[model samples]
Target: MLGELAEKGVRVTVEAEELLKSREADLELIVKLIGLQKPLISKEDVESLLKPPELRPVEVVPAAAFAPLAKEFSSDIRLNHTLDVTGKSRTRGEVENFISYFRNRYERLSRMLRRNGTVQTDLADVRKRLNERVRVVVLISDKKETKKGNLLFEVEDMTGSFKVVVSQSRYNEKILDKARGVILDDVVAITGKVLEPYIIAEEIEWPDLPVVREKSRSENDVATAYLSDIHFGSRYFLEKKLQSFVEWLHGRGEARELAGKVKYLVIAGDVVDGIGVYPNQEKELLVKDIHQQYAMFDDFIASLPDYIEVIAAPGNHDAVRRGEPQPALGKDLVSSDITLVGNPSSLSLEGVKHLVYHGTSIDSMISSIPGTAYAHPEKVMVEYLKRRHLSPIYGGNLIIPENIDYMVIDEPPDVFHCGHVHKNGYVQYRNTLVINSGTFQDRTDFQVKQGHVPTPALVPVYEMKHGRLRTLDFNY
Candidate 1:
């Protein structure tokens, strides 16, 4: 090996050679080391090639515009794997835990409805009274449209489940329309007269999001750029456009002024398009190997401004388990400076709580909810807020049923950030800024067939000081 390296004009230090021998360097590894074109190979060079690089803390700009703002603000950001319950439950435990979790959600929502003069009656407690009227709140477990046009719902509570009927005659067009929009696994308040073996529902009520009249904002000026679904390594990856955005972050053009004020860059999910993600995926891949795909992604991150803290989470297409609450990318895939958090993570930036989810479950909600469409993603996000859960509908999305029920949004965040539908959406729901970060990957063949024209290279910058959300387009 020494003679071979000498032939290649590369000199290996005595220490490097001793270290390699101690580590029992294989022939292939020795050949690879010799390939490193250097007149002299030092201990550090050999060590770097052999071991993973040391992780460094995210660089903080001393003269950052938000430095003073951060002093007054304290972040209780949930660190990586802080409250993860994935891979920590048995089949029976998962079933029992979720049942209990949903039941708790039901009780909490029912109490809120009760405060509004709507009394909740358990399915088992309701009895058919002849010539008497009955109105109660119930959780709808199942619903079916009858051939004669009446709506039949199988609702349940902790006690039991029962059948509720909504006749087209008693209810007006508006009420009937509402009944038709009723999705299963929703907690609702039904009102009307009670008949034999059936409680005719005159009105159906959803556990709606409460109106928040006042919203809070930071006293000092600070902002964060929201991005997701870059899908690097795919043929559709918008490399030039994304490069432009990165340049803008490092101070370029009119965006330079805004760039200086950006304290953080939050990437929600789908950082890279993995291998074998879907059928015929290889046909659209520019980088065939998953490691190479991540290498390209890491290079992109390396070009980003070190002063800006970059936080990333995984999505369905990421090289993680095909389930919600996905773990962070492997050490080889992502750089150390970037904070790799779990899917459906809760982030605290200067004490401002922001819930970041990849929005995989949004697909299920779009199909299940009537008024919802992919064109208006923020509308569906409202359902998660109303339920105070990230992915509430079980069996809709591929979620690992953990014991702690991490899907439940225990507390309202100042910002609810999600991305996955490849569209941009923003709205203020009950003082929470709900935003769906757009994608970097342009329209692919699959997306074209699905009628989705992704709004690529658009980043939503949330200004905490002003409590304002704005989108910056870099497609040009």
Candidate 2:
């Protein structure tokens, strides 16, 4: 009945039907909704009579005209790997795959660390040498403090695992500090002396950022605006401020001059106030139905100027799997008009490669790294780039692993855009512009309790010509 209704311009989904059923609405109420003055009588007019005013029926459009910029610069925007594969491994195979993947990561960094003059020894070899000085690279499997207050680490290699001890008395302040900051699963080079069953560490080394940076600046005058976390249908959604931005894009106010130059808009994710996304979410939602929520989002996007091509990716709140390498929302939710891609996707806007990630793993990044915090998201972005992987630690965030590590930064992007922290941050790392686009939603009760001040309605526009960034404030 819903599919038949949709065919005649009435849009309905499982979510919408459930909401409607909850009301136990009569035909008269349904007729009034579709703006029909005539009474509901004939079966032929049933679909048109029940169609809601707000739900704009989906219209198919030619994809070529506004196809994602990724198509144009396919060579530059490389999807190194993805987890969208069938026949995923069984329990034992999954464990083996995880171990093998990390082992490869360990070996790769180990070879890189070898240039630092650390004699590379396997975990098995380290066990052989008792009461002798040794240097080795290993993946930290586990770490704990003893009753004696010394940090003990169970590090492993392909050969085997060994216990590494950082004695409070023996190791100096510098070594202890590094040991304290050591993250589990992080492959590190350790220089130490072998004890009875443990290696007493002298120094710990991380695969830090490269000194020489490679930057890209476009010769073209085109610019792109980065945005995310719109959370449409939430009471906190900044409708007025966002409309002001759209007005600016349509050549209004001080931003009128920038309107012509801005050719692309990248939305990182959390595009809607998803149904049942959190506890007490219904109280916060202005639109309770998921289809209605997306309908509003679709209308909002449709209102934007056609000159600026919009590229969107899904986040945790989107109607997709809650895992890394999440696919785009279904066509039923999002029309073909938007260039929708998977989360953590890469594209190029006029020669400038952009890495668009929802940054759901930002929590993990902040917690795992000692100095990093939510307020300074770019610091975490820098850490991700330095490590050349997004969300390195597995258990921190929900992830569905594939044969290849899709999170690995095999190909570096010129512009990296992410959002989820709701705090805007921008920085340059090795020539790449790392930007946390922030949110369009106002501060909620949760944010207030957390003491997080979101930088809403501040759109970061990147001037591709000179690699310069200018922020446009629409709060006024």
TM-scores for every predicted model: 0.77, 0.76
**Per-residue lDDT of model 1, residues 381-416, tens digit only:** 988887666765677877665545667665677888
The per-candidate count of clashes, in order, stands at 0, 0
Model 2, span 1-476: residue lDDT tens = 34334444655445555545445436565544455433322443444445666767789874333233322322222232343221232323377776666655665666666775656877777767778888877878898989987889998877888889988775377787778778777777888898868888998876655567676666666678889999999999999999998877776667455665777788998999798877889999998898898998888888887656787888888877777667777788988487777777777666677788889888998887789999999988987776666777777998766445556564577888999999999998877889999899999999999998999999999888777799999989
Least accurate stretch of 10 residues (summed lDDT) in model 1?
66-75
Give candidate 1's error at residue 350 in angstroms: 2.1
lDDT against the true structure, per candidate, is: 0.76, 0.76
Clashing pairs in 2: none
Model 2 TM-score (2 dp): 0.76
User: After aligning candidate 2 to the native by TM-score, how far in Å is the CA of 216 from where it should be?
Assistant: 1.7
Model 1, runs deviating above 4 Å: 1-118, 128-137
Give the best candidate by TM-score.
1
Q: Best-fitting candidate, measured by lDDT?
A: 1
